[model samples]
Target: MPDAIDLYDPDGYVDGPPHETFERLRNEQPVYWQPMPDGTGYWAVLRHADLVAVAREPKTYSAARGGVVLEDLAPETLAMMQDMLLAMDPPRHVGYRRNVAPQFVPRVINQLEPRVRTICREIMRDAAERGDVDFVHDVCAKLPSQVVGELVGIPEADWPQIHAWSERNSGGQDPDFSSGYSEDASNATIEMAMYAIGLAEQRRAEPRGDLTTLMLSMELDGEPMTDIQFGSFFVQLVTAGNDTTRTMLSSGLLALLDHPEQLAELRADPALIPGAVEEILRWANPLHYFRRTATRDARLGGVQIAEGQKVGMIYTSANRDAAVFRDPHRFDIHRDPNPHLSFGTGEHFCLGVHLARLEGRVFFEELFETFPTIEQTGPARRQRSNLNNALKSLPVRLCAV
Candidate 1:
């Protein structure tokens, strides 16, 4: 088994993403078959071009067919997931996304910058008061929770509960974040969905000027969004908004610290923060991969993928593809034309892309400005999950300016 590499094992990711193995696979077999513990396996698409090809042709590689994870979810769970934009295919996905796209466009997202910056300032001030913190939970997690909560018009008091549910949903593979039972993860989804359903009911009666009200008023397939559909969509938005942004901020800090020269450069020139965030995302993408099932037999990277087989567009590998990225392994804030697939591509590109970039840019700018000296106090711990490439804990000391 010396030559064997298990991409399916969550434990393999606890230390870090298996980049060395990924490089080897990318070189030898860009489209490799990986076996899961459940006696099933997937074709891991390691090359950037191949992954993009799979994403572009959604008709051939359906997100709705089997849902977007390697493990087949429970029948009910898969049904609920199918309602989300991430799991929907082109024609239907297009309509659902179009209904809400107005809310997340650059103009709409830019309007929230001042609020986002204010949230960052408050969070940084709180972190400064603490002096030392588990940066992941205490610092990085707050901005997204508040931003998303306010945008959705969820009561500020419920933000923590929403954050908790989001963590459990994505951190099911990590014991630090979830109970060993899969039921707990499912329950988190159900609980969040129920909360959303109640909120939708309230908004329908007394409409407000928030995304929730906008979504509730909008129609999909020429019919108003049903309560259950709203519930599913809410779960997707909250979970994606909370988890991925938190990961980006925490992981971005760690990446900056790892390269102090780059960190200093950013501090010297704050204008570089936006590019730095992009590089950080490319280096440490929040999601490792999203799954899609082949609708019919097709050839990918010269390999035959049979119908109904799971295919993983391995972003972690594709981000560092030597063919696309010059000096791929080296972290550079000024990596121009860095076409990383971190936010994905094609029809299923991230809905909150603008908001995420805004949060990232503002959070780092505020963090550096508020605390002149920020240093890691201890070892960073990573989440044990193949799907979520995230840090579980990052201990740091923030010295106030």
Candidate 2:
């Protein structure tokens, strides 16, 4: 009660993260407890090392016991989440990830450059025509939705609907995006799942060389995945791929524009774009935190955690932990050996990290190449959500060279 900081309140994050509070918490109460409106609370692991420790020991703090969100989900939803890569822990996570891992490796994902570049090129071209636009939905989001659709064989006509579904699911905490976060989520999730089921059935009847078909062909624990499993997996891939990638691109551009010198450096040498992407992720991470349920009594950051307690690894705080980085608060694109936990660490590390990185690098390179003159047309408005640290609207005016 002393600090009056509530991590659970989405309104508190409407403007931006309370860094001063996090800085104070990281120093004083590295392991902070926060109460929620629903009479339940979570242990906020704020430091860099503590987050890594909690993430590494998935057995003690299980992602499957409860879904990866701060709030508890309904029974049916929790069950569906248990099958997601975000919720699985240990042997099961290991098994499923192993089968799907090869598809996302740097080597394989790198091959997506030409196709991805073409997509970005077209997107940039369209944005260039509209000199003034809301970069969030109009420009930044197009590439990911299109690229993910191509990757999963989702029909070109359905990409807009798929993107909307993903937005509703991930942006539920924002009332502007979702009328009722829970209801919208349930509806969007079911709609997407049904679509995935139909898509899987279609692909099963006529196999193709696409990610969806590859996923269908994969088996977990010596058994082929059920249609339901395929549906859940499809939701995970599309939502994670489309939503997070779009956020990264939008937020990354906003970060660069905020720091014109950095943007200038990036334009001068396109090679620096990769490191710029890493810095952007570190400074402006897409998701704020991922939750885990403690399975047994354990001590983390010198605080005792009991069984059935919800624990959240606050990536926003961890990325800026002074103990980890020399200038944690500073946004330096060339921050070497940057150990930001944006993509996360260990077993549940983001499956699309390589793809995200590729998109960031290519998108920026194309943006700078195409738009010789770009400036902020209006103030950027951030999404009102503790879970999603992203922009709801970024107004920019760009002129093509």
Candidate 3:
């Protein structure tokens, strides 16, 4: 019936996540093997505990072996991804992660509160003046571009181009966003990489007090990062930070409007916004899944996985695992003990976790403080992609507080 459930189809999620299909798979086939269009297949690890185990044992389940996506990348692309921390194996991954981990720690991230608040204040004021805007691009997407560009020391005038490249890099699956993903993504990556390399070259001769300068001064394994290495690193931070932050904002607001009582509770008590952000992440994780290749033949969730086979930690399914989260489907602002794997776990856990949480908490608090009420002007439109579970457009009308 309907060729069973084609999890690989990008069109499958236009309406919403195939929750029924995922739930059935998690129940009957926790270690589900789904075939791909190219005759290859992958084991979808659909349970929360199973994913954690996979994430924990990096030696057994390797992110570096095949990069972190289902599609087989070109040999050049695979090599390029190996340079980024996202796909690097341990030892090397640990070394690279340690170099810049200080910037993301709470102590440093906390200092940005006033700056973040200022950014939100400007955004809210713009929303109030326009009264009607596309929350996705016009409002939510603007913050990450400026914040990330400035953080990296990119010239202020280039923020918009950098953001456009970041959007194309992540939005390849949707036709509205890109005509063909391979060329578009590759071109975007090349341009951004070149820009990063240029920045590194310029900073080498004339350094500035910014993250770019920090990265240049930092050493990995007693050696400085090469220009190519820096380019890949820069792309990972810009695209990853921009895409996920925007998704959280747009998708999170839709979640609030969909449940007014919860929204009211949040507005009544701003202190609860932190927990609300966690719930939003749990309920609507930004990415559907991340791929990891089996280092050796092994067993997981009672299923045998062969060496080099594609294994995906399906975050969308695991976040709703009944065994983990009680009443998982319901949107509750006070979702306690929420151990969602949206930021992942283990070595590959999102390094930007604290910064992302801070952005979410401040964005919502500022939103409610600046607007007495916010209403959806139209139906929310989601990006048509299996990988990026995000909204492409969210129209809203704001009433000033």
- For all candidates in order, the CA lDDT equals 0.94, 0.91, 0.90
Better of 2 and 3 by lDDT: 2
Tens digits of per-residue lDDT for model 3, 221-282: 57887888889889999998999999999999999999999999999999999999999998
Pitting candidate 1 against candidate 3, the one with the higher TM-score is 1
Instruction: Specify the highest-lDDT model's number.
Output: 1
Give the Å shift of residue 375 in candidate 1: 1.0
Per residue, candidate 1 scores C-alpha lDDT tens digits across 189-306 of 9999999999999999999999899988878678988989899999999998999999999999999999999999999999999999999999999999999999999999989999
RMSD of each: 1.0, 1.0, 1.2
Q: List the residue pairs that clash in candidate 3.
A: 372-401
Which pairs clash in the backbone of model 2?
Answer: none
Candidate 2 achieves a global lDDT of: 0.91
Q: What is candidate 3's CA lDDT for residue 231?
A: 90
